[model samples]
Target: SQQGEEDPQALSIQEGENATMNCSYKTSINNLQWYRQNSGRGLVHLILIRSNEREKHSGRLRVTLDTSKKSSSLLITASRAADTASYFCAPRDEKLTFGTGTRLTIIP
Candidate 1:
């Protein structure tokens, strides 16, 4: 609970369908990140949106905005330590729709 609260925590959709998740936050944020997982890995970066940005798109992933509390530290630490190329940000909107068939790779 250090960041945005995602709704319908568990979601199920068909292979070609879109999966939408809502994240509502109290305060404003700078940027937001969307992560893709492959059942094995934790968070695989899918997209990034900045505070000044209103929206973003990637293959089948769309991000608006969300509110996160203490996750800033976790995001920053992970980026610098693991060098896992993880992504983070504060979304401006409250909805996220991920395309189940899309794939993305990030290197930092």
Candidate 2:
């Protein structure tokens, strides 16, 4: 298992519903970060959780880190159609190593 590999490669949800995505990594890390990408554009940083932290939140996004399990999850509350995008988790070292993203689609 490589660092920052996301699960359930794709997801579809209706507007106002919540979306959750999970990422698992192989090695110990200093920090884990989540990002969102619309279409082919650049990634937008959502949240970053340090290995010492258990959870964090920003806006409608909630991020959880479980260092013991080497996993992290992202939760998006009250999802909107505009929230449709590809989400990724990356492990922070000297540089970030991003895994394949999970594509989320919000239906109207």
Candidate 3:
């Protein structure tokens, strides 16, 4: 599996605070994608930044990719309690090879 690893397996943050997670992979990739999973529901695509890209943003989320180090990071600013969820990074492919994931909790 060309899956990456997310650090700080778990994190707790208060509402309105920012949350950040990092993912490190083993090999070269065509692209990297970030997704969010809430409880038992399906995972939702948050962003997808290609290998040639350095950074991208979507609303309250900002992502940075470092091909040299084979790593990526996701930052969620102005987080709300409703943003609590598990975040995972998956390499671009038909069937994604996802990371262990970061279990994030936003305290109300």
Candidate 2 residue-wise lDDT, 1-108, digit = tens: 245889879999999999999999888888999999999799998888999999999999999999999999999999999999999999776677788889999999
Residue lDDT tens for model 3, 1-108? 588799879999999999999999887888999999999999999999999999999999999999999999999999998899999998764468887899999999
| Cα TM-score per model | 0.53, 0.95, 0.95
Tens digits of lDDT, candidate 1, 10-103: 4443333344555444556556555545545666665676766655665545665423342221211111112222233334345543323222
TM-score of model number 3 = 0.95
Q: Please report, as a residue range, the 10-residue window in candidate 2 with the lowest summed lDDT.
A: 91-100
The local lDDT score (0 to 100) that residue 2 gets in candidate 2 is 46
lDDT of each: 0.42, 0.91, 0.92
Task: Enumerate residue pairs that collide in model 1.
Answer: 31-89, 31-90, 32-89, 32-90, 65-91, 65-92, 65-93, 66-91
Candidate 3, which segments miss by more than 4 Å at Cα? 93-95
Ranking by lDDT: 3, 2, 1
Model 2 bad stretches (over 4 Å): none
Give residue 3's error in model 3 in angstroms: 0.6
Better TM-score candidate (1, 3): 3
